[model samples]
Structures are given as C-alpha cells and as structure tokens.
Target: MSETSAGRAPEDAAGPAAPAGPPGAPAATLPYEAIRAIPVRHYGRWAAAVVVVALLGALAYGFSQGKIIWNTVGTKLFDHTVVTGVWHTVLISVCAMAMGLVLGVLFAVMRLSKNPVTGAVAWAYIWFFRGTPVYVQLLMWFNLSLIFQTINLMPFYKNDTVAVMTPFVAALLGLGLNEGAYMAEIVRAGIQSVDPGQTEAAHALGMTGAKTMRRIVLPQAMRVIIPPTGNEFINMLKTSSLVSVVQYSELLRATSDIGISSNAIMEMYFVASVWYLVLTSVFSVGQFYLERRFARGSQRSLPQTPWQKVRTNLTTLRRPKVAR
Candidate 1:
C-alpha cells in the first residue's frame, strides 16, 4: 500500500490522538465555561413593597397634618409623673407575673393530680377565672368592701377590707388571678409535651413524684413554658392599663391624668404609645435571650440574635463576587 494510505488506515483504526503536551508537563485540560444563572424577578414582592411604602408615607403625612401637640408629647415624655407611672407599671407587671406563675404551677400540678377532689378544684378555679373578663374582676376586687366590710384573720391579722384592698392590691389580684388561669393551661401543655418514658425512667430510678417533677420534668418542660410565659408577661404589661379603671395610677392612668390637666389628650396618648413600644421592645429582647438559654440541648443551632442577623446581612451585601 501507499505510505499515505497505510498511515491513514492506522490513524482511522486507532481513533484520533490527543494533542501533545510539552515535555515533563501534565496533560492539557479542556477550558471550563461557567454557567450564568439569572435569578427570578419577584414582581409581586416589589409591588407589595411599593404599596406598603406608599401607605406608610400617607400615614406619616396624615399624622403631621393632625392637631396633635408634638411639643406636649416631648415635654411630658420624661416628666416625674410619667416616670413614676412607668415604674408602677413595671412593678405591678412583675409582681402580677410572679404571682400568676406560682398559681399556674400549683394549679397545673393539681389539675394533673390523680385525686378527683384536687383535680376538680383546680378545674373549677381555671374555669371561673378564665371565663370572667379581667376588667370585671378588677371592679369586683375594688368594691369587695361593700360585700364584706372587714377581713378577719383572727389572731394572725385583721383589717377593714376597704383598707386592705387598695387600688394596687385590687389590680394585683385581678391581673394575677386572671393570668393564672391562662398560665395553667400553658404549663399543662408544656408538661404534657414531655415524654412519658422520661417520667417512667425517673420512677424506676427511685425518684418520688415530686422529686421527678422538680428535677427531671420541670427543667425540660421549662423550654416549652418559657416562650409563652414571656409572651404572657408582655401582654400583662399592656393589660395593666385596664387597672386604671379601678383607680390604680399605672402608666395609662398617669398619662390620662396629664392629658386632662394639659388639655393635650391626643398628644399624651402618643407619648403613652411610645413608652409602651419602648417597654415591650426591651422585654422582647430579654425574652429572646431567655429562649436562647433554654434552647441549648433542643436545637442544632440556636437562632441568631438581632445584632447577629444584621451583621450577617451586611456581610452578605458586602461580599465580593468571583468573575465567571
């Protein structure tokens, strides 16, 4: 055969040869082509955002044009009376929450008891308290003196009911007792969420019912209980305003008094709203940390704090992209 034909036959039989590389060098690799991906455009999200911004702008303009006295709001924001009212609000909220927590735990245990009498009693307490409006309860406590003029504890203590049941006391009883009913349900639900096996294991370990509950069950249940309790406490802060009806000089009552005296009623309301926002926001931060503390064993990773979230978002925005 001819030389060209013979060489062509061999090349065809063997298939195409790879391109040669320089001596002592690695084989050449095919060049990489990166894919350019386009992200989806959410026109709906953009439209919603624009609508929200427009609505917010309209609200701001409306408030600006209203007859609200901004000067009065600023002037009274930190007045002695307003500060005192804020103090009272916090004081009452804390006290009431404490009382409610105790009552809730007690009632929850009783409600879960095997004894029929104790369970029935707990059920009735929860039912009645939850059934009634808190406002009505406050009024009832304030006027309790009319039904029973004096409270007698015999050798321990005795006093006129009216004297004993001050506005603060009445408010406390009203808010705390009402809160207990709701908290009992929350606590019960948390307790029920715990595994029955854990309780049985505790029993097998020679722990008494109360010991098992306090040591094993309660500690675990707290993770569930804390979130709702924090929410209840925040709600209690706002609900404390209703105590003003019973003549308790809480934040709302104090603000209203100022409004009446200064004739800047709407402005005073704005001040009260601002203070409420501040107080709730502070408690919300506290609640977040508290929840994080309890989430140690339960979560694979704890949720990011507000500051952490902000930092992560900023970092993402500033990150350098690789050229394709």
Candidate 2:
C-alpha cells in the first residue's frame, strides 16, 4: 500500500496498527533509584551507651561519698581474695564434672540394664536426687557429720572428736552427687539417640556388648552428650554459688567476704558478676564451637562464621524500633 509516487501514508503503517492492546502483557518496568537505595538505620543505638554512662556516674557519685577507696573494691579485686575464689570456682567445676561423669555412666548403665534390680536402684537414686533441691542436699551434707557422729576415712586418721566434714568436702559431695543424677539422664538420652542398627551391626561383627558400647555407641553418643555436657558445666559453675552457705571459699563466697570486709555490697557483687561473666563467656564460646562440631555430622552445610553471625546480629539491631 505504498503511495503511488504521492505523499500518502503506507497502508500497513496507517493508524499505528491498532495500538498494542490491553490483553497483551505489560512491558517490564525498570527498578526506580529510590527503591534500589538501601534503607538507613536511625541513631537510636545510644541505649546501651546511656546505661553505661549512668552506671559510671553512679559509681563516681558514690565514690564521692567517701565509702569507696583503696581499702574497698580496689584492694578486693587486686588482692588474693578474688584470685582464690576464681581458682576455687574452677576447681569445683572440674571436680564435680569429673565425679558426675563417673556416676553418670554408672547410673546410665544401671538405668539401661536388663536386670530389674539394677534399673530400680538407678531409678530410685535418680528420683531422690533429682526430686530434692540441691541447696537442701548441701544443707544435709553440712550436717551429715552430726548424723554420723564420728566418720571414718582411714584407720590412722580416724578422729577421736566428732568428725565434722569441712565445707569444701560437703560442697563437693553435694554438687557432685546432685550433678550425677541429672548427668545420668543426659547420658541415657545420648545413648538412646544412637541408631539401633549401629549396635546390631557391631554385634553382628562379633564384638562383645561392652566393647561395642565403649567403642561405637559411646562415640556417637558423645556427639549428643557433649553439647549438653558443656551447658551443664556452665550451669554447674553458677550453681557453685549455692556452696557459699556451707562456707566454701569459692568465688561467690570470696565476694561475700569482700563485701563484709569493705562494707561495699554493690561493688563486691559487681566484682562477682564480672568474674562470672568472664567464665560464662569462656564456657559459652566453647559450647558454641562444640555444638557446631556436633551439628556438622548431620548438617548439610558449614556453620556460619563468627563474622557472619555478627553481621546478622547487627542487621537485627539496625531494624527500626517498634512497640511490642
């Protein structure tokens, strides 16, 4: 339909070909610059800073009251008291955990036994210990010598006087035995979490029950056992405070002594909290890495790195404040 040597529109080009009608799909739109720009967070992050500043101000004002000086928190932290308490805290945690591990395994086996006697004994032990509060156990242990009158550890060392157990020994027994009950359950659960086929396969290989369990089941069980074990250890660290009642010279007790001597209760308490925070932080890091290792056995991908975790935390923090 070209014009025959004239200035007329071509027939096919006329009227713009009826426009590309509404039924046709819309053209893709480009992203706007505004939407493409990343959102910014407001400067609402001063909450922690403000709280810290207020705490500092309080301390300064209180010090101005002349109650805090060289003889108080300064000497308490720098002196031997805090150091001895920290050492005691570590000692108690290590000893208690070791004892718990032994008894935990023993009772775990008992609980898993085919013999009704063994199972019942384990059940009764667990029931009593887990049922009673740990503080009560400590109190009872403190008075156990009163019940026994003259206790005997060795023939030559047998005391003529009423053999009263020291606060240290009482604390150890109370915490260790109580931990054993809970640890037994943890051990049992770990062993059970293993696949039955594993035990069967080991047996089919002519391995004895004890050997198979020791080499195979326990190893797999550790993957489950360790994460909770770490957590329990941390919990036990805190629980060590309960031993203060018995006059153990552990961290909290030391802090208490400092408080009494200095008459600066809050300062000594803060000092205790700082040490606890440090220890707990250390345990927390260990727990996290151990959990990561255990999880990797069944996980599809690598765990997030510390930096990635930090970034994720920052992202959450940067989110807008809102009413709960």
Candidate 3:
C-alpha cells in the first residue's frame, strides 16, 4: 500500500498542463474584417435640392424662350462703343485698386501705430470715407471746382480745378478713397490674425519694424488678406457702374448711350449684363486658383478636385461586400 501511494503521488505531481506552443510561433490571430460603412440618407436635404434644381431649370427655360429681342442684344454685344467702354472700366478699376492698395497699406500701418496722433488720423479717414455714400462722394469730387477753383502748387504749377478734376479723375478719387477705407480694415484684420510670437521673434533677431513687416509678417498675412481683397476687387468691378451717374462713360454709361439712341433699352441692358457676367465669371475662376495657391502651406490635406471627388465616390460605391 505504501509503494502504490508513492507511485500515485509522482503521477499527481506531473498533473496535466497547457500544451506548449512551437518556438517563437505567433499567437493565432482573427481574420481581418473592415468596419462596415453605413451611409446616412438625409431626406430633407434631397428634397430641398430637388426643389432648387427645378426652380433653376424653370428660370433658365424662361430666359431662353422669352419674347426678348435677342437680335438687338447680339448686335450690340460686340459693338465698338461697348468694347471701348469695357476698356475704360478696366482701366478705372485697375488704377483705383492700385491707389487703394497703397493707401490701404499705409493707413493700416498708421492705424496700428503706437503714436496716438497717427492712429487717430487713420481712424478719422476711415470713419469719414466709410460713413459717406460713394455716390455722394463721386458727386462732390466731380464738382470740386466750386470749392477750389484752382490747385496751387507754387513750386511746380497751378492748375484749374476743373481741368485737373475731369470725370475720369473724379471717378478714380471717389472709388480709390472709398476702397482704401474698407481695405484698411481688411489689412488690419489680416495683420492681427498672424501669431504674435512671429513679431516677437522678429524683434529678437534685431530686425527693424519695417523689415520685419515686409519679410516676415506680410508674407504670412497674405494668406488671410488675399481672399477678402479679391472679393473687394470683384465688387469694385461692379461698383464702377456707379461712375455712370457722374458721366464717366464706363461700361454701363456707354451701353446706356446705345440703348437710348437705338430705343432698345432692355436689349442693350441685357447685352451689358451678359458682359458683366462674363467678366465676373473670369475673375471668379482666377480668385479660386489664387486662393488654392496660397492655401497650400497652411492646410495639411488640400481640398480634393472635382475629378478626385468623383473617383472617390466611385470607389466607395464599388467597395467589396462581406458575407453576412
């Protein structure tokens, strides 16, 4: 009995244990299964989209088939006067924008200055220009000869105010000065958007204020500044139509001349609208590309192009199905 008990103890000591895995064998892994994708259907959005498309289609059909005189519009679309007017409009917008850019940047800097007098002066300028209606300002500029018959530049020459303040000149001054007031705010906002550390770092490097602004600050601020400036530019293009009130003979004025003479007012206006639409469309495309160019450094992943988006949608739809 003692011998049998001793043998049983040895067997119990070697009791059953977990089976050993092969040397360095990895543990068994579950087969990979992609997460199931569930597409959300926004019924309200789909209904709204359908309604909008229907409305747009109806409007387009009406415009195309309406009893409007397409012949007159076609004849005047490329008229010499219309083309010349477009040129004049372009010239005015370019010059005014240039003037506005210079004054805007200068006033923006002055507005931000630590000097109370400088800041106050800039503030006053912006306030006055922004407060006044652009039409009234244009009229005031057009009649400046009444206030100052002559502008005396003793060292250079004195010119009659009327001679200097032609319709073109008045238009330029009114648009540019008004635009500068708005642009000042835009530039100031852009500069403020930049991280304050950038300015401190510039100072630490012993850089002058002007140098730092030109090299470090403005470059980075451009990404923010460009979008609004483009919007202002496009708006300026449309606003130049107001110069017609002062007889500057811009696109609208020239088109009006033809309409009145030919007694085809509606047709001429339609022609002018078409041209304006074309110009705005061109600028819109340009603005889009410009924004994309400036956005490259800031975004981690750039927005997908139309084609890329289409391809992505196709791939998503074609994703392989797993057995239920």
Candidate 4:
C-alpha cells in the first residue's frame, strides 16, 4: 500500500488506488437515478399520466359548462343503478361460469363417450344451444313457466307444493346453458391439447381412466382452458343484457326503465355506456392477468407483462406483420 508523503512515500505512488472510497461510503452515497430507473416506455406509467391529464381536462370542462350535467348524470347513476348493476352483473357472471363449467365438463366427456346414445345427446345439446340465439333462448326460458304451469322440484322449491320458475331462474338457465355449449368445445380442445403420452403413461402407472383425467389431463389442460374461460365470463356479463327482454331487472333493463320513465333516452343510454365501459375495462385488465397466469404451461413461453404486451403491440403496429 502506498501512502501520502507527510514523512513517507510520495502521494503519486497511491494515484491509481487513492480515488477508491471504502465500500460503505459508495453504498451510503446511493445515486437516486440508478436506484429509480423506470423505463420511459412503461405502459402503466404512460397510461397513468394520460388518464390523469384527461380526467383533469374533463373536470375543468365540466365545471366550465355551469350546468354540471356530467356530474348530475354521474350522481344519478351512482345513487341508483351503478352499484346494484355491478353486483347483479357479478352474480350472474359467477353463477353462469359455475354452471357452464359443470355442463362443459360433462358435455366434453359425453362427446368422447363410447356410448352412441350419450354422444348423440351431447351433440344435440351443442347443436341446439349453439344454433339458437341466446336472446331467443332467454325468451323461451322466461315463457317456460307458461308451459309448465307448476314445477314439482320435490323440495327445493316445494314451498307451495307447486312452484313456478321465476324470471331470474330462467335467465340463469338461459345464460348458463347457452354458455356451456361454447365452453364444452373449449374444454374438449383444452383436454386434447395435452400429450396423448401423458394418458398412456398414467395408465401404465396403474391409474384408472378417471384418475388419469382428474390428475394428469385436467391439470395440464387448465393452461389452455383458463384464458378462453375468462373471455367467456366477460362476454357473459355483456350478453346478460339480453335478459332484459324477460324483464329480469339487470343493468340493461334498469337503464331502459330509467330512460323511459325519466324521458332521457339519449342521456340514459350514455349513462349505460359509462357503466358498460367501466365493467369492460375492469374485466379486460383482470382477464389480461389471468391469461398471463395460465400461459405458464402453454407450448409457447410465459406471456409478456402488460408493458411488454403494449410494446410488442406498438412494434407490430409499426411493422404490420400478418399474424399466423
């Protein structure tokens, strides 16, 4: 080691090493820029900045209008339909998803069944549900009570010994059953996506067909299934509007009612658009993350993060490559 020439070696001897501070000193003097190196192109950062500016501009313009029509309309929606609409929408989505999943699994098995009767029945179900319009189905379900008069559900709805199906039940069945047809195909495709070797291996390991399906097949298939399932759920929420024809008092029905009663046709529709936009935006974001989670087992690599997705999208837009 070299030292300063107070009574010793010349300082020039220590030249190369002198600037090196103790490790603790460099750590203590952390560079803020290095610590915070957020890339400028990050999606959330740009989106946040854009949203803030847009919101501020809207607020300013709304105040300048003197009438505050946007606020008034916003207050009305919040006071009445928005919250309840969201709840009902979620309830319908959850119920429909559950019912659809069960039906889809059963239908998939039936489609793969050796028994001709079971396969035919499954095919007929898919044909009817997929061929017919969902709106018509909802109408049919609501009117089913007209044909059945009184249902003998044994004990579930046997309060009066003869219970009639309500509009809500009809709507649920309509949306759920119809959704199942589409989900059945998704389920079948997802199941088939797994390697056939996996099934054979499971059998060689003494696993029963059902055991192999449950343990090996379905688990692997989820990566294929979940993304589309999320899409269907979101679609279901939007499509549930058709239930309004049966007067089920869902979001669309309420909006129509308010519009007619309040004589604010255009405005009420605008209000409805706001609700739909909000729901779609929230669900889209959620679906994006859900898709990422499921992508882990996909043949392709794990999905890009939202920022990466945006960057890729922008890059594609610039190049305009045809997707295979």
Candidate 5:
C-alpha cells in the first residue's frame, strides 16, 4: 500500500470518500430518472371486470324483453289499493322500529347490569325471541285470545279483551317485540365497540353513568350502530309482509288480491317487487348519508363523494403519458 507523509494508507489520504452526496441521498447513476412511476395494468382484473359487466348487461336485457305481462304491472303499480297498502307498510315499519329501539336500549342495559337476575332475564328474552321463527310468533300473537279470554287492566281501561287484541295491535306487538330482541343484540354489540377508556374517563370527570353513556359513549358507538340498524330497518320493511298472513292489507297482500282478481298473478307480484326495490333503494341512500355523518371522528379521512371520485378518475385518464 502507498503511504502518506504521516504513514497513513492511500484510502485515508482520500478522507472517507466525501460521503458521495447528502447523507440520505441515493448514489448517483446513469439513467438518472430510472425510478419512474408507471401505472400497473392488471390485465386479469380488467378482463374479469369486463366479463362481469357484460353478464349483468345481458341479464338486464333478458329481464326487460321477457314477456309475462308488463301492462298489468304498469296498471297495478299506481293503483289506489296498492298505494294504501304502501302507506300501511310504512306506518307499521315506523311504529315497530320505534318500539324496537326503545326496548332494545332497555334490554341491552339490563344485560350489561351488575345484577345477575336482570342479566338472566335479558338473556332469556333475547334467546326466546331469536330462537323462534318470526312467523310462528306472529301467528301466536294474532290468535292470543285463545289463551287469554280477558286482558284486564282496571286502572288503565274497562278490562275489555276485544279492544286490547285487534289484528293491528297483535301485528304491532309481534313485529316490535321480536325486533326488540334482535335490536338488543345489535345495541349491545355497538355499546361494546366503544373504548372502555372513554367510559372510565367520563367517570373520572364525575359524569353519571347515564350522562356518560348518552353524551360520549353512545355518540361514539353510533358509528358502529347506525349501519346495522339501517339494515334491520330494511329487513323490517320486508318482514312486514308476514303480517299479510293474518289478513293485514300490506303491499304484498293488496297486490296478491289484485292479481287474483285480474288473473295477472305474476305481473302484480312483479309490481310489488319493483315498489319494494324502490323503497329499499331510497333507504340505502339515506343510510349511506347517515353513516357518513357518524363516521367523522372514527375515520382518518372522509370518503370521497361520487363526483369527487369521478373527477379523480377523469384526471387520471387525462394524465400525459411519460416516455421511457
């Protein structure tokens, strides 16, 4: 090795090679822009998407062209009888859901109670309601007078059995109570989703249990709660048809009556399906906005609006190509 004047080696004479460039900078090389951003075209994914779209389009075209009876569907769709049925469906759904929400919150709290008796009662309620078919429950409620000849409430009413158990009352009780059981579980899950630390912090700040729950925990839990609750509402809307078995004139029953009278069975059923689809679509859109509203603190960033997403896609498509 070559020696310096102070007996150092030749590499020592170069003074540690001057570190190339800045400390974290990569080493310089030819084809300086080699680290380029190239859009990856996943041919398999693109092909699959195209195939799925084609299949859906074909199915839609087939459905439109298939001849059962379009005239009957159009005529029955906006009939006064059908419209009345729609209103009844909406009323029952709203009333049942209101009852369910109230009872669900109550039972969920009971289930979480420190008392074993309360917890057991809540558990049994959920178990019995959830275990049985809703159809059976509805049937039993409609025919409840067989078991109870007189429903007596002296202070509240005249102890009359007939007034207490009409088809409407039975339907309401059946739909609402069963829904309460399901909703209880849903609410319990949402409550559990909230961080225990938040509750503890609220306690530390001297808030009452109810106050903390109402102010902090429930607000947070709603992010988890709202989606499933919306789904339940949609399910309830469909489930209202079950009341038709008891001669309640809901949408399906009315449509069925029309079909039987006019001899356009399939067409009237199709009209009911269309109306149901339209209602569900409306609910879905509402649910989406409700979810977005509640997702504020939980999500790191809000989801993009459809228009924003479309604009982004358009910008990407219009981007100038980079030359190799």
Candidate 6:
C-alpha cells in the first residue's frame, strides 16, 4: 500500500495530462478563419445614378429630334469671315481687359486713399459707370459727336469727336470703363483680404506707401485677385458680342451676316456658341493653372491637375484586391 501511494503522488504532482489523440496523429489545431465583412449596399445611390442616366438619355433624344442643320454648322464653322471675327473678338476682349485692369488698380488705390477728394472722385466714377447699362454707354460713346463737336487738349492734341470716337474706340471705352468699375471693387476686396500686420511690417521696413502696395501687398493679394479676375475676363469675352450693335464686326456680327446671306440663322448661332464654348474652355484651363501657380504658399498641397486626377483614378481602379 505504501509503494502504490508513492507512485500516485508523482502523478498528482504532474497534474492531469491532456487527452491523447490516436497513435502517431499530429496535435489538432482550430483552422484560422478570416472575418468576411460584407459591405453595406447603397440602394439609394444606385437609384440616383439610374435616374440621372435616364434623364440625360431623354434630353439627348429630344435634341436629336430638333431641326438643327448640322451640315451648315460644320461648313461655316471655319469660314474665313468666321475666323476673322474670332480674331477680332479676342483682340477686343484682350484690349478691354487691359484697360480695365489699369483703371481698376488706379481707382482701387484712390478708393482706399486718405484724401477725401480722391476717394469721393473714385466713388463717383465707380457709382456712375456701374449704375448705367453698358449698352447705353456704348450708344452714348458712339454718338458723342452730337454733344461735343471736338475733343480738344489745346497744348497737345485736338480732334473731331466723330473721327476719334470710331466704333472700335467707342466699344473699347464702353466695355473698358464699365469693366473698370467692377474690377475696382474686386481689387479693393482682394487688397483688404491681406493682413493689416503685413502692411505694418512693410511700413517698419521703411517701404513707402506706393512701394509697399506694389512690391509687398499686391503680390500677396494676387492669390485672392486672380480667380475673380479670370472669371471677369471670361465674361468680357462673352460680353464683346454686344459690340455687334455698334457695327463693329466681331464673331457674333460676322456670323449674323453669314446667316442672313446663307439663310441658316439657327445654324450660324450654333456655330457661334460652339466657338464661344471652345474659347471659354481654353481660358478656363489657363485660369486653373494660373490659380494653382499662385496657390503655392497658401496651400500645403496644391490641388491636383486634371491629368493628375485622371491618373490617380485609373490607378485606384487598377489596384489589385486582397483575397478575403
């Protein structure tokens, strides 16, 4: 009995052994199962996509049934007169924008000046130009000869108002002056957006008012100024169409002439629209790049270009999915 007890004590000290499997069999292990998470189905998003696609299809079908002469549009799209008109439109828009920019900067400075006289003058100029319709201004400019027989600067130059106020000059003044009033407000807003501390710093550095404005403030303010300025320029391009009323041959006027002669007014209108779209799209791309360039110090990461966006999307689409 003593020998049997001693042998049991060793077994007790060792504790209960695990149950054995079949002879020579490997230890059993629970197989690892990865969690298969099912994504939530967005039925609402799918429904919205279907609705949008259906609406687009219906619109396309409707336009397809319209009486648009596509051949006429194609034929006259690149006609010599149409091309010339496009050139003139671009020229006038550029000239007017340049004039507006100069006047805007000048008046914007005046509007912010300490002098009551200068500020009032600037305010009055802006108020009058902004208040009047651009069409009326154009007509007034065109018919200036009726009011003043001559434009005289006795010491330097003098001319008959009719001769000096050609259709081109009249259109330029009308468009440019009106644009300046709008641009002045834009420039002033941009200038004000800059930190007052920046100006104080410039003053501390012994920079004169003019130098500080030109060298320090304007550069910084450009970030705010560029976006709206680009939009205004694009608008100017479209507004140049109104010059046709004054007999200045621009894209719209040229197209109208061709339309009258060819008896395809609607087609010409379509062609003009296409050209305008093309011009606007091209300028839009330029504006995007310009804005990106000015965004350097403001943003840690600049917005991606259209090409970069496309590449990123494609890469995401092509990436391999891990097996569940």
- Locate the minimum summed-lDDT window of 10 residues in model 2: 13-22
lDDT of 2 by residue, 1-324 (tens): 244347666456432223343676664433335334444654565787788899999998886796445445555675587989999998998899889989998999899989999999999999999999999999999887666777567865665222457888888999999999999999999999999999999999999989998999998898889988998999999999999988889999888887887678888877888889889998888888887887876888868867789998898866555433
* 1-324 per-residue lDDT for model 5 (tens digits): 233446666564444333357789985542335556687777897799899999999998998898777877887799999999998888888899999989998999899889999999999999999999888988898887788777766787554555677777777988999999999999999999989999999999999999998999888888888999999999999999999977788899999999999899889899889989988888888888899899887789988766688999899766467667
The total number of steric clashes, by the backbone 3 Å criterion, in model 5 comes to 0
Tens-digit lDDT string for candidate 4 (1-324): 344435556546534234457777752332234343443346786699899999999998876775434654666577467567667777887898899999999899799888999999999999999999998898888777557666667766543211444667877889999999999999999999999999999999999999999999998898889888888888888898887777777777777777788776656666777888888778888888877776665547776777898998788555343333
Best by lDDT: 1
TM for every model, in the order presented, reads: 0.90, 0.73, 0.82, 0.71, 0.82, 0.86
- Best-to-worst order by TM-score is 1, 6, 5, 3, 2, 4
Q: Which ten residues in a row have the lowest lDDT in candidate 4?
A: 27-36
Ranking by lDDT: 1, 6, 3, 5, 2, 4
Query: In candidate 6, what are the lDDT values of residues 91-203, reduced to their tens digit?
Result: 99999999999999999999999999999999999999999999999999999999999999998999999899988999999999999999999999999999999999999
| Candidate 1: tens digits of C-alpha lDDT, residues 61-146 | 99999988788889999999999999999999999999999999999999999999999999999999999999999999999999
Report lDDT (CA) for all predictions. Answer: 0.92, 0.84, 0.88, 0.78, 0.86, 0.91
- As a TM-score, model 3 comes out at 0.82
Question: Mind giving the per-residue lDDT tens digits that candidate 3 earns over 235-272?
Answer: 99999999988789989999999999999988989988
Model 6 alpha-carbon drift over 4 Å, by segment:
1-41, 313-323
The candidate scoring highest on TM-score is: 1
Segments of candidate 3 deviating more than 4 angstroms: 1-49, 64-67, 305-324
Pairs of colliding residues, candidate 6: none
lDDT of 1: 0.92
